[model samples]
Target: MKLRHAMVCSSNQNRSMEAHSLLKRQGFDVSSYGTGAHVKLPGPSLREPNVYEFGTPYKHMYDDLRRKDPELYKRNGILPMLKRNSSVKTAPQRWQENAADGCFDVVFTFEEKVFDMVIEDLNNREHKLMKSVLIINLDVKDNHEEAAIGAKLALDLCQELEAVDCWEDAIDDIVAAFEKQHKRKLLYSISFY
Candidate 1:
């Protein structure tokens, strides 16, 4: 059976989206979310904050940014990124705010902060189904280049896991292999970039 997965990051724009897209391309059932209070990004000016709520339509935000400061949006590549991100099934959501769906078999977080938030949400929730979900924290920075690198690492791990028939029985070994690969990838990325 294909394992259901979820990816989490500070903002749904970069890291989470990258992993989500990669996983989906590989034929896995996956979803991505943000753990922040609101979607935040660099605006036209230093003082301007591009803040968007969870339910904000991606197109709305995109159009607003385009109209507000077309040059800045294009210059930062946010326009194209937003266009790609808008195609995702769901909008940005907070881990704590969403109701427990018990759909995901594994959850991957791009940073420690999002990892903690996922754990805290799982702990505080009344649903026991969450206990069965395996949470993996991959220390990836939230940037265009880093997001792409992290997605490649995540895809490698997922492909490894996909080969195993019994996921629960093989989780420990899978995690160990993932960590080893992640470390190697991180080192190689440092040298490469």
Candidate 2:
């Protein structure tokens, strides 16, 4: 099966943005969005990411995170895929525009509230063709929670995307906790109707 067209949704775009880039590096077609149609960073936004002299997304994500919130990026380090070119994490306008169309094969929500919303909306749509919606809770809003959890979640999601073949499997590796990860379901818990 050709797995194409995936979307990651979060209350805020930070972690989901990172997930989108990492999934692309793993050769999966992916996009991302925020539940609230946020247009830009709230305040003290990180500037657009520039190619680190060495060209890795790690440097870009970390450096940007550090610039925006040093303490968080300090706790968890960034790891680039070596050959992958860094992308400026999702711009607010980019996600809002794409998600407005609502065309995605797999929609994974990192935020608990967003997860419920997406699932509810998808079920209400009544199309029910061949789609799966999952709620893989992660601490995406933690830039306020010492920032470390948010940074760590972003870093780990990137790591998961490196070897994952399917969206559901990638999420299965993460634990139920808001921060730590442990492989359990590995897509075994999911089945399409």
Candidate 3:
């Protein structure tokens, strides 16, 4: 089976960026972009809390997988010619063509800006491939915050779809929540697709 497509969008690479990385590690075909696409310069606004630098570790994790996983891009010869220009590239004004091309199963927006922009754009477009898109904001707090945010985001994602009987993953978080809230693990079936 093909892996599901997931996209994450956030303003200034922070919590949302972190979630994007973790999702990719969990084996989803994921991509992340920032909401600062129109910014002409990298400045104070980005350094401020909640702002993440474009192309920084905040948005893409595991330390430059392009270099490490050369095999994945061998056919395109992309691994060897890593460009330093990406350090300052503008985030996309909208979700990229690939996502719109019907390759994605879901898209998650981390901040209000991204959700407002991307969701409204998608909702207005007439694309048969745009099946399900979710816009959600994570409630942020203190230190150890990354792990807290990551875990909760993952669990919550599994829960939301499970509530509607729409996911097939065997997440203990979702299963247990159903048992606790609905009082039955045996309530539903027909596999999540």
Q: Best-fitting candidate, measured by TM-score?
A: 1
Every candidate's CA RMSD: 6.0, 9.3, 11.2
User: lDDT for every model?
Assistant: 0.71, 0.47, 0.45
RMSD of 2: 9.3
Q: Which pairs of residues clash in candidate 3, taking residues 3 or more apart in a chain or in different chains?
A: 12-51, 12-52, 13-52, 167-192, 168-192
lDDT per residue (tens digit) for residues 140-176 in model 3: 3322355346435654563355355444464345546
- Give the Cα-based TM-score of candidate 3 against the true structure: 0.49
* Candidate 1 worst ten-residue window by lDDT: 184-193
TM-score of 1: 0.84
Clashing pairs in 2: none
Model 2 misplaced stretches (Cα beyond 4 Å): 44-90, 93-97, 100-103, 128-130, 144-193
lDDT of residue 122 for candidate 2: 56
**Stretches of model 3 off by over 4 angstroms after superposition:** 1-3, 38-98, 139-152, 159-193
Which residue pairs in candidate 1 collide? none
For every model shown, what is its TM-score relative to the native structure? 0.84, 0.49, 0.49
lDDT of 2 at 118: 62
Best by lDDT: 1
